[model samples]
Target: MRTVLHGRPLAARPRRQLRDHGDVHQDRLAATFADRCEPYRGYGAGAFTILRKIRQGTPWKEAAGSAFNGQGSCGNGAAMRIAPLGAYFADDPKTVTTQAIRASEVTHQHPEGVMGGLAVAHAAAVAAKARLTGTPPPDLLGSVLDHLEDSFVRKGIEKARRIQTAEEAAYVLGNGSRVTAQDTVPFTLWVAARHLGDYRAAITTCVQAGGDVDTTAAIVGGIIATPPREWRDEREPLPDWVRR
Candidate 1:
C-alpha cells in the first residue's frame, strides 16, 4: 500500500517512474524496511536467496541470473510482490501489464516469471476496476484472462474457471508447490476471482491449499484486497514488518 501511495507523486509518468520505484522499493524493503522493525524469522527461499546476493554485493541482474542454473528464476516472487502496482494503474490493464514487465525484469528475467507478474498485475487491475464499477466476482477471472498472452498461464487460468472451489483450484491449477510462476499465478487468480468480495475467504483458501502458503497467500491477498470490499477483522493482520 505504501508503494502505491509513494507512487502517487510520480503519477505524471507512472509507467516509467513506477518501474524505477519498484527497484528502489525492493532494495529498501529488503534492507532498511526490515531493520526498522522487530526481527522477522519466517523463511522464503526466493527472498533469502535474493537478499543474500544483494548483501554480498551482487547486482540484481547477476543475482537473479545466478538462480536456476543461469536460466534465471521463474518463481512467483515477481507476481507475489506486484499487485499494488497493478492497483495503482487500475484504470488501464495495458499499462498494468506493461509496467509489470518492467518490475519483473529487475529480479525475474524468465518468460514465465514475467508472465506471472503480468497475470497478477492484470488481475489486480481488473479487480480494482471491478470494485469501482461494482463488477461481480464471476467476471473477474475471465476479464483478466482476456488480456494475458502466455499460453501456459492462459491454459491454467482457463482451467481455473472450470474449478468449482478453492480445493479444486489447488488440485487442478496447483498451489505453488513447484515454486514456479506457472504453478502459482493461475490458482492465486482463481481464488482471487472466486472471493473478490470476500477478502477473508480468499486468504483462507491460500492457507488451506498447503504449499508455498506464504507466496500463494500473498498473491491472493494482494489481488483480492485491491478493490474496496468488506475486510473482516477476523482475518489476521499481516506482520508489522510487512505493512511497514
Candidate 2:
C-alpha cells in the first residue's frame, strides 16, 4: 500500500523536476518543494518555467501557452504523475476524466496535455477496477480507450491494441520521444495492458522501450501496480532501489 504510492514520486522525479504538485499557486508550491526536496533542486525547465510564470501573476492559460512562444506545452508532464489520482477514484471513469482535466489545466493548459492526463487516469481507473473485480488481462487497453474523447489519442490506442510487443508499441505509438501527450500516453497504456499482471515486467517494458523511460515507467508502473498485493503475487518483488 505505502509502497505503491511511494513508487509514483520516485519514478516521476528522475525524469522531470516537478512532482505533479497538484494545482497549487505555482510560486508557493515551487518554493515549498524546491526548498524541501533534494530532487526538486535543479531540474525545472519546461513545465516548471511555465509554472513560475503563473506564480509571478501571469494567468495560467497565458503562462502555459507562452512556454514555446505561445505554442503552449503538450508535454507528458500531466500524464507522468497522475496515476495515483486514477487509483484513488478507481470506481468512476467519468470522474477520473473530469478530474484529470482539472488537474492538467493547472499547468498543462493545452488540449493534448489534458487529453494525455485523462487517458492515463482513465486507464488507471480501469486497471484498478479490474484489480478489484479479478478481471482477466485481455482487452484492458480497449477499456482504457473507451473513456477517451481525443481523436489522436483514440487512434493511438487503437494502434496499440494491434501491437504485440513493447518494442512495436514504442515504434508505432511512440515512446515519449516528442514528450507530447500523444507521443507518450498511448504506448504507456499498451505496456500497462501487456504487463498488467506483472509489475516488474511493466517497469521493464518501459525501460526497454526507451524514450523518457522514467515518465513512461511512472505512468505504467503506477497503474499496473495498483492491484492489491494478493492480486499481483506473480509480479517480481520491488527492486532494491524501490524498496530502499
- TM-scores of all predicted structures: 0.75, 0.75
Q: How many residue pairs clash in all the candidates, one count each?
A: 0, 0
lDDT of 2 at 163: 86
Q: Write the per-residue lDDT of candidate 1 for residues 8-52, one digit (tens) a residue.
A: 212222233454464334444334322322214443465457656
* lDDT score for residue 120 of model 2: 86
Q: Cα-based RMSD of the predictions, in order?
A: 6.0, 6.5
Pairs that collide, model 1: none
The parts of candidate 2 lying over 4 Å away from their true place are: 1-44, 226-244
Q: What's the distance in Å from true for residue 110, model 1?
A: 1.7
Q: Write the per-residue lDDT of candidate 2 for residues 59-82, one digit (tens) a residue.
A: 666776677666667787678767
Candidate 2, residue 43: Cα displacement in angstroms equals 4.2
* Pairs of residues clashing in candidate 2: none
Query: In model 1, what lDDT does residue 101 have?
Result: 79
Q: Considering summed lDDT, which 10 consecutive residues are worst modelled in model 2?
A: 10-19
**Best candidate per lDDT, number?**
1
